[model samples]
Target chain A: MKISEIARLVDANIYCKGNEDTDIRCAFACDMMSDVLAYVKNQAILVTGLVNPQVIRTAEMMDIPCVIIVRGKEPTPLMLEIAADRGITVMNTKLRMYSVCGILYNHGLPADEGE
Target chain B: MGALHLEYTVAPDDFSRAGEVSGIVKRTLKDLGFPPAVVRRTAIAMYEAEINMVIHANGGKITADITPEEIMIVFADQGPGIPDIDLAMQEGWSTASEDIRDMGFGAGMGLPNIQKSTDYMDVQTTVGVGTTITIKIFVTQ
Candidate 1:
């Protein structure tokens, strides 16, 4: 799915105009940066309620093109700066994490491909 | 032969800057055209250690030696060291404060995740003294 489509699907606000055109095949939703780092696959979108620099750092390390902040949380200035600097698309939704995951998963975004 | 050497001092609770060193090292590896897998694993391992330094140790210094064969990252800290290595290495063991948990870490996944990303990992710790972790990731075709 595309970033714009996911944003519309989850009712999120796009905080970065990065390469949203990048088609993502899977998505990983978790609040733990460790889990995100340990399990995420290439070109995946990270959907989490964790709003911090580590979120963007994890995205950068994993080469994840997009990060969706759920629970109506706001990304810190540092988070936004790094996301923009790294060319990562950052978005946020009022929907909670489980809901966020369900919506995206129902939209044909692969949740997990079994490692 | 010895290759690139990098060092950085992490400040206590400096959430905004925890991954600076890792980011730089990752970019350097990518610029050098290391395999994508190698670069990503190196970056994740180093970043986890960096976050651990801030969250658990209050702060520390990291030294990295990068060569064609391997990347060795040493994390040295003077915080209250781990009393039990076995417990700390477990996937779900953590001693981090609630504040650390709010940041989306402290779920006891740092050490295990580090081990998962690197080819080899060694931890030397002394209660009340400190801990030094060395992780070496080798480059392979």
Candidate 2:
């Protein structure tokens, strides 16, 4: 799935440009960075409400190209700077975490490496 | 092959700056033309080790040696050491404070996750001395 499609489907506001078309190989929804590290195996989109620099660090390490900040939570400036530097598309949606994940899952995005 | 050595000092308890060194090494791996899968594994392992240094140890120094066959990263910290390596290695066991968890870490998955991402890993510790963790990843993996 393209990153822009996620943004449109979830009613999200993309904070970074030029990465709208980045291919999202999978999706994982969790605020726990450790779980993301332990489970995410490939290019996955991180759906989380946690707004911190470590989130970006996690994505960067995992090579996750997109991060969706849910519950209308926007990322901090430092997070945005890091995401921009790392070429991660940061998107924010007003929908709760569960709804956002359901929408993406319904759209045929695999939740884990097994799929 | 001869390895390229790189070093960075981690400041204790600085959650904000914890993973900077790992990030740099991750980028360096890419610049050196490593495969994405191998690069991501190394970076994630190193990142976890680096964060553990800040949260558990009183911060530490990370030295990485990069070679065509493997990348080795050593994390040495001067803080209260791990009393039980077995427990520390267990999943869902952690001594991190609530503050650390609030920062999105301290899920007790650090060491285990590091082991999963690396081809080789070793841990050495003493009660008062500190802890040292070395993780190696093969390039051909």
Candidate 3:
């Protein structure tokens, strides 16, 4: 699925549009950075409610291309700056994490099965 | 190609600047034409160690020796060292406080994740003194 389509489906406001046309292969939703690092195996879109710089850091480490902040939580300015610097797209939605994940899953975005 | 050595200083509990080193290393690996898998593995392993230094120790020093064959990284910190390596290595045993958990880490998966990401890992520690973790990932051409 293209990143823009996912954003449209979730009604997300993309703060840092890093390759909006890029295709998303899978999605992983979690508030725990460690779980994302331990479980995510491919380049995927990260859906979470966590609003910290570590979220961006974890995505950079895991090569996650996009992060969707759910529950209307806004990312810190530092997080947005880092996301922009890393060329990782950052978005936010008023919907909760579960709803965002469900919407994306319903749109045919698969979950990342860890290796 | 000659080996490239890089060093970074991690500020204690500085959550905002935690992943800078890993980002630089990742960019360097990409510039050097390493495979994506190799670069990601090296980045993830080193990033976890860097976070550990900031969270557990009061920050530390990170050194990376990158060559065409492999990348070796060492994280040395002078904080309260791990008392039990076995217990600390467990997946669900974490000593991080709730504040750390609110930041989306502290799940006790740091060491195990590092182990899984790297080809080799070594831990050296002394309680109340410090800890040093060394990890290496080979670049397959």
Candidate 4:
């Protein structure tokens, strides 16, 4: 599925327009940035409740095209700006982390290398 | 072709500017047409190392040598060095402050993550003097 589709599916508000058409495969969900860093495997979409610049940095480092901030956490202006500059899509959803991950999984979105 | 060399200085105490080097390096590697997996791994490893430099060592310099066969990244910092590398290498042993943890890091996984995401990792440190890390990730044909 494309990032735009994920945004709509989760009722997320996209803060950036990164590759809306980019194909998204598995999703990695974590608030622990290091864990996210340790386990991310070509997952294009990152679902996190953490709202911070490092979140953007992690997504950028992993070449993740999109980030969906769960739990309705608002990202700082700097974070949004950075994501926009990097051409990475950012979105916020009311769904808590577990429900967010579960919904995506139920929709056939694999988790981390699809294992 | 000689490996494309890149270098960056990570300023100490600058949490906001962390990962700048890794971001640029990632872009350069992608633009060079490296395999996506190779590019991703290199970016992740280097980025984690970069963050570690800023958060732990107050800042450092990163040198990356990108070759067709492999990419080598060396991170050197002049700060309180690791006292016990073995303990530091553990997956969940981090000394980062509570503030850092709130920002989503400091989970004692920086070194481990760098090690796991890279093909090879080497660490050299001297307490109160500094520490240096060398990581290599190969791009197989």
Candidate 5:
């Protein structure tokens, strides 16, 4: 799905417009940056409630195109700056982490391909 | 022969700037047209070590030497060094504060992750003086 479609699907606000036309294949919903770093699932979108530089760091290292901050958490100025510099999309939504993950998963953004 | 040389100074206090160096290194590898697996390994190993430096040692300096055959990363810090390198290398032992843990780090996986991602990793640390970690990821040429 295009990052724009994800924002529309989840009612998210795009904090940074970058690579919006990139199609995301899968998603990962986790607040633990370690897990995100360790698990190489070819996930394209990272949905987490944690707002910090590490989130963007993980995204950049993994080449993830989009980051969704759930529960209306605001991205700090540094986070936005880093995201902008790296050309990674950032979005915020009012829905909680689990709910947002569920909605996106239901809409065909599976967290992983299979067991 | 060394192909590309890079150096970055990690700030001690700013958690926001933790991955700046690793990001640059990753981009450099990408621009050099390294294979995806080799680039990913180098990025992951360097990133984990960078996080460890930020959380455990306050800050440090990272030096990366990239060659066609291997990428070597040296992370040196002057904070209170790891008390027990063996224990610290374990999978679940962590001395990180609650705040660090809350940020989704300090799971005692940094060293192991670095080891896993790279072809080889070595740690040299002194309790009061400082610590320096050297990690190498070899790419099939």
Candidate 6:
């Protein structure tokens, strides 16, 4: 799914648009940066509720191009700055983490089964 | 390609700038034309160690030596060292405070994640002195 499509589906607002047309096939939802670092494989979208600069840092480390902030949480300015600098798209959604994952899953976005 | 060396100092408890060194290293690897997998692995491994340095060790120094065959990274700190390496290496074992946990880290997966991401890992520590971690990720053509 393209990042723009996911934004539409989840009613999210793109805070920093790095690449709206980037296509992603998988998603990993986790607030713990360590789990994301340990498990995420392949280029996928990151769905997280944690609002901090580390979220952006984790995405940059994993080469994750997009991060969806759930539960209407706002990202810090440093987070947006890093996201913009790293060419990572940052989005905010009022939907909870579970709902965002379910919506994406229903739309054929498979979970990133880090293997 | 000729060997390249880089170094950076991490400020203690600087959560805001934790991944700066890893970010630079990741970009360097990418610029050197490393495979995406290799670059990602190196970045993840180094980033985990960098975070540990800030969270546990009050900050440290990270040095990266990059060669065509592999990238070697060293993280050295003078903070409270691990008393039990085996227990520290275990997943879901952490001594981070509640504040750290609220920051979305301290899940006790840092060391394990580093092990999973790199090709080789070596840890040296003293109970009250300090700790140093060295990791190498081979470049596969």
Best by DockQ: 3
* Top model number, lDDT: 6
Which of the two, 2 or 4, has more lDDT?
Answer: 2
> Candidate 3, which CAPRI tier?
high
> Residue-wise lDDT of candidate 3 within B65-115, one digit each (tens)?
998998999999999999999999999889999999998889999999899
Model 6, B30-141: lDDT tens per residue?
A: 9989998899889998898999999999999999999999899999999999999999999999999898888888989999889988889999999889999999999973
Per-residue lDDT tens digits of candidate 2, residues B61-96? 999999999899899998899999999999999999
User: Against the hidden true structure, what lDDT does model 6 obtain?
Assistant: 0.92
Model 3 off-target regions past 4 Å?
Answer: none
Per-residue lDDT of A14 in model 4: 82
Instruction: For model 6, state the Cα shift of residue B130 in Å.
Output: 0.3
C-alpha positional error of residue B2 in candidate 3 after TM-score superposition, expressed in Å: 1.0
User: lDDT by residue for model 1 over A1-115, one digit each (tens)?
Assistant: 7789999999999988689789888988888887887777566888888888889988998898899999899998988999999999999999999998888888898785535
Task: Order the candidates by DockQ, highest first.
Answer: 3, 6, 2, 4, 1, 5
lDDT of 6 by residue, A1-75 (tens): 999999999999999988777889899999888888888887889999999999999999988999999999998
What is candidate 3's lDDT per residue for A1-115, written digit by digit as tens?
A: 9888988999999999788778898999999998998899989899999998989989988888899999998888998999998899999999998899888888899899875
Q: Write the per-residue lDDT of candidate 4 for residues A67-106, one digit (tens) a residue.
A: 9998888988989889999988989999998988888899
* Alpha-carbon runs more than 4 Å astray in model 5: A113-115
Comparing 4 with 6 on TM-score, the higher-scoring candidate is: 6
TM-score of structure candidate 6: 0.97
> Candidate 2 vs candidate 6: which has greater TM-score?
6
Give the per-residue lDDT of model 4 (tens digit) for B11-64: 998888898889899989999999988888888888888888988898999999
lDDT of 1 by residue, B1-141 (tens): 449998988888788789888999999999877889899889999998999888888889999898988889999999889999899889989998898888788888889989988999999999899999999989973
Chain A only TM-scores, each candidate in turn: 0.95, 0.93, 0.97, 0.94, 0.94, 0.97
Q: If ranked by lDDT, best first, what sequence of candidates would result?
A: 6, 3, 2, 1, 4, 5
TM-score of each: 0.94, 0.96, 0.98, 0.93, 0.93, 0.97
Model 2 lDDT per residue over A8-98, tens place: 9999998975466677768889989988989887778899999999999898888888888999987899988988988888889999999
Task: Give candidate 4's TM-score.
Answer: 0.93
